[model samples]
Target chain A: MKLEFSGGVLTAFIDGEIDHHTAPSIRETIDKTILQDKPDVLRLDYSGVTFMDSSGIGLIMGRYKLISSCSGKIEVINIPRNMAKVVKLSGIERLGRITIKED
Target chain B: MKAINTMKLEIESRSVNESFARVAVASFISQLDPTIEELGDIRTAVSEAVTNSIVHGYKEGKGKIYITVSIFENAKVTIKIRDKGCGIENIEEAMQPLFTTMGGERSGLGFAVMESFMDKVKVNSVVGKGTSVTLEKKINGRFVTKW
Candidate 1:
């Protein structure tokens, strides 16, 4: 339901659904982690993630901005097919910054 | 008469984060061992529901939104997203695909997408009170419940 961070890599093992109703928690968790751990890299594992919309794009973009500002890299792995469709449609892949991998 | 297995959250409308919420909930339900296609369906349904709330439910401005996700032991998960904002005047018209009231930019496919992906979809709305959407789906097979 929230963020579970560990290792040198801070992973947000997000639970429940991610939407306008649930994104702020993720944003806050990521922001807080960035400030605290200052991890060199951030990984958003979408393997467990279920749904996403255009608003989800903004969430990833915001994190990209946050991590980039801190001189850190952001990678997205284990994305599902349906969710991937939306992400690709957003042209985020064109940015070539979000690293998507299968689970 | 069974206790609802649900997780609830209240979120702000200003910050962009609904996608994260949708994905998170989908990930949780996927643990029930849904097939690849079933997983996709769940994800799409969640996305459509969340998008509707963000784009239509809270269109006026920033406000509080409620999202609840429930996974039954039978591999049927229900997601209820609610918002207290200007409600739709006609549910039937709004449910129509490509019937977006927001100019033509709105795909008007929110409910359609949800129906296409989920087993059951229900919307309850009032002209001014608010709107509540409930989406339900049953995974292909059964699984031993693990907590």
Candidate 2:
């Protein structure tokens, strides 16, 4: 997964599967960006993502914790519905807008 | 109603390459108009399962993890993940929330996350053979086909 930071949005365009192995890097990348850039909106665009598991869940929850402390908002766009069901059940709908795009 | 289809992929238990997979699966399944919370739930659940296979099953060694998915006639989705590593001794105890046999850097929320996301989750393991997990969810009102 590659993370790009610009202006008030810290965007991460993740690819491949997100599990425990990938969470640390993702967390580090986003954390560094969030701390350094301190963006108002942390956008995670999942246009390239393919697979994910619960550790990926932990990643988002952890990010939510970090951004919440700084009063920053997190938005996840272009999420697939299968993953969307998992995210919605986690009660993260209150955190950001989850949109499904046609491919 | 259109006939449902199935998709399957086998991936290395490496964490570096899963982000793209997670995003792709999430984006593909988003036709159901899932909420952000639901997306997070699915990602977290998948993460836990894959991570468990990597850390616990393979112990960071090289191994193959099979992830198979199926979509039912009603747009229901099911994923089957399997690992041929050190299997579980007891499935019942393992499924308990906050149970961690690893005892390091883990909160033991894996099974909990999986059960929370998919409509149904089934796990089967043998002490010396392997482990398999099946996750299911219903995707309603989507017209897209399998990719």
Candidate 3:
């Protein structure tokens, strides 16, 4: 996971399969960045992610809570079709808008 | 109803093995020439089941998770994930969407995902005994003759 921050916006570039084994670390990193950077917007880039399950949903929900508490916004970009289904099924759009980049 | 092919695997109830289990199942079922969407659904469903065993059943403790997959002649696949760890007290409640006992760390969508992805999902559990989740899906007509 790589994070870039600029102009009150933090973009997280996450790669690999986001599952139970990796979600904790990802959550920790995002939380730490949100705390230190205090970015007004959190953009999650999921183009490189090969797989994801409910654990990924939890990660996003947890981050939404943290970012929303600070009155910040969250956006998910470049979600693959398969993952977008999971995200939509989990009703994550209620928390933030998910943008799918054309491949 | 005899299965045309069957495979069974037993692995430690560890988080790291979740991906391995899913990928293994997907590879095995690739013989049926499932579409990309169907394969993804099966992998996602298997991932949820194995994750439930590791997180809820084993609670990060040591245990064994058994995954049994069988492909029928009709192109229907059945996957059973069993764990000899702490089982749920109420199977009905556990199957509910967003009902997690792990506080906020979990999304409580394991069973929900399985139900959505698979045609049928059956959860059988006895507290202090163990839990087994059975998921079944029928692959639509998309057989790859190359295999």
Candidate 4:
């Protein structure tokens, strides 16, 4: 995961598969960034993500709760079509905005 | 034409093997020339099933996870993930979305994701004995039959 903070938004470029094995590191990295930076918006860019399972849902939910506590927002962008389906099926869109970044 | 092929893999129930399991199954199914979407679905479902075996099934110590993949001439694939860990006590309750026993850390959508991605999902478990999750998906019509 690559992170950049600009204009009160922390953009996280998550690459590779997001599963139980990788979620913890991703979570810790993102959580630490969120806690320290306290950005108004956390934009998660998923274009580089090849695969994601339910663990990705948990990661997103956990971030949503953390950001919400600080009055911040979460935006999921550039989600791959297949990953989008899993996100939608998990009903994660209700917790945050999911925008497909056009290629 | 009818053809049947079966392959079984046994791996240690560790979190790291989750990715290995998915990639192995995905590679095995590639013979059907599945689309990216189809491959992603199968990979996601396999990851979920294997993760469940490692995290919830064998919570305390190391165990063995068995993955069986069967491919049919009609391009239908069946995957069975089994573990000799602590089987679920309540199958019905466990299938519920967002009902994880691991508190808020787990989303409890493992079964949900499997059901969504696969054509059929069946869970058979006997507490203290083990749990087996069977997933089946038919390749899209656009797929080519290589074998």
Candidate 5:
């Protein structure tokens, strides 16, 4: 995962697969960035993500809580077509809008 | 369904091995010529069950995860994943969505996702023994030739 913060927006470019084993590190990195940078918007970019399970959902939900706790909103963007079903199934829209970046 | 082809995999319960286990099983079943949707669903389901073994089951310890992938005729498949870790005391509560034993780190959606993607998901466990998750999927995909 890669992190970039500009204009108070912290965007994480998630790559590869996300599962229970890999989610913690991604979560930790994002959380640490959120605290240190205190970005106004947390944007989780999934353009490079090839696969995900429910563990991905957990990562998003956890970040939602963390960001919202500190008054920051989260936006999940650029989801691959294949991974969109699981994302929708997780009901993450409550956290915010989920936009799929078109190729 | 009668299993015409079968393969067994045993891997150490390490976080790093999670992707290996799922991809291995997915590759094993790919001979059935599953559609992309079918393949993706299987990969996601396999990842969940194996991760459950590593996380909630083993819980920060080392163990072994046993996986059995069986390919039946007519593009149907079944995967059985087992682990000798601490078992769940309550299967019902555990299956509920967003009910994580690990709190915020986990989404508590493993079983639920398996149930969604697969045709059938059966979970059996003994408190002190281990847990076995069996996921079944019938591929209604395009025509295929079996190798």
Candidate 6:
């Protein structure tokens, strides 16, 4: 995961497979950034991710809780097609704006 | 049903081996030439089952996770993931959506994903013994076939 913050938006570029093993590090990074910058929006970019399960959803949900308490919003963008179904299944659309990755 | 091919895998319950476990099963079943969507679904389901063993069963401790993949003659596949860790006390409560013992980062959706992605999910556990989750799915087999 890589972070870029500007204009109160902290965007996390998450790549690779998200499982129980990798999620903790990714979560830590994002949480640290959120705590430090307290951005007005947390954008989770899933464009670079190749594989994800419910762990991905957990990551997003945790962020939602963190940012909500911080009085910020979130945007989950560039979701790859292969993972769109799972994302939709998690009913994440209710939490933030989702922009699907174009083929 | 007779198994056309079969493979067994055993790895310690570590986060690093999660990808390896899922990908190996997908590759083993690739002989049936499953579609991309099918492959993705199986990968996600397998990941969930394996993760349950690592995060819940083994509880961030050291234990071995056993996995077996079998491809049947009718283009059906079954993957069994087992662990010799602390078992679930309440299978019914555990399978509920958003039900997780480890809160916060845990989504509590592992079993839900397994159920959604696979055609059948059978879970059998003994509190002090171990837990076994068997996932079954029929391959559309659009890409190739030797049978």
Tell me each candidate's TM-score: 0.57, 0.58, 0.96, 0.94, 0.95, 0.97
Model 1 Cα lDDT, one tens digit per residue, A6-62: 666767665545555566677787788888888767777766665554445556767
Candidates in descending TM-score order: 6, 3, 5, 4, 2, 1
Judging by lDDT against the true structure, name the best candidate. 6
lDDT of 3 by residue, A1-103 (tens): 8999999999999999999999999989999999999999999999989999988889888898899999999998898877877887898888887776686
Instruction: Give Cα distance to truth, residue A42, candidate 5, Å.
Output: 0.6
Clashes of 2: 60
Report lDDT (Cα) of residue B35, candidate 5.
88
lDDT of 1 by residue, B1-107 (tens): 35246788777654355555566777777677777767766666776766676677778487777888887766678888888878788999998864667642334
- List the RMSD of every prediction in angstroms: 9.4, 7.5, 1.6, 1.9, 1.5, 1.1
Worst 10 residues of 1 chain B by lDDT: B101-110
lDDT of 6 at B141: 71
Docking class of 5: high
lDDT of model 4, residue B46: 95
Tens digit per residue, CA lDDT, model 2, A16-72: 666676667777888888898888888888777665555555666677778878899
Candidate models: Cα lDDT each: 0.69, 0.70, 0.90, 0.89, 0.89, 0.92
Measured with C-alpha atoms, the lDDT of residue B18 in candidate 2 is: 53
Mind giving the per-residue lDDT tens digits that candidate 2 earns over B42-127?
65656667777777777777888887766666567776778998988889989887677765335467887788766889988987
For all the models shown, what interface RMSD does each have? 6.4, 4.9, 0.7, 0.9, 0.9, 0.8
**Per-residue lDDT of model 3, residues B1-147, tens digit only:** 999889999999888999999999999998888889999999999999999998889989999999999988678889999999899998988899999998777898988899998999988998899999999998874753332
Per-residue lDDT of model 5, residues A9-79, tens digit only: 99999998888777888888999999999999999999988889998888899999999999999999998
TM-scores, chain B, all models: 0.87, 0.84, 0.95, 0.94, 0.95, 0.96
Give the CA lDDT, 0 to 100, for residue B31 in model 6. 82
Q: What DockQ does each listed candidate score? A: 0.12, 0.21, 0.86, 0.81, 0.84, 0.84
Q: Could you say which candidate leads in TM-score? A: 6
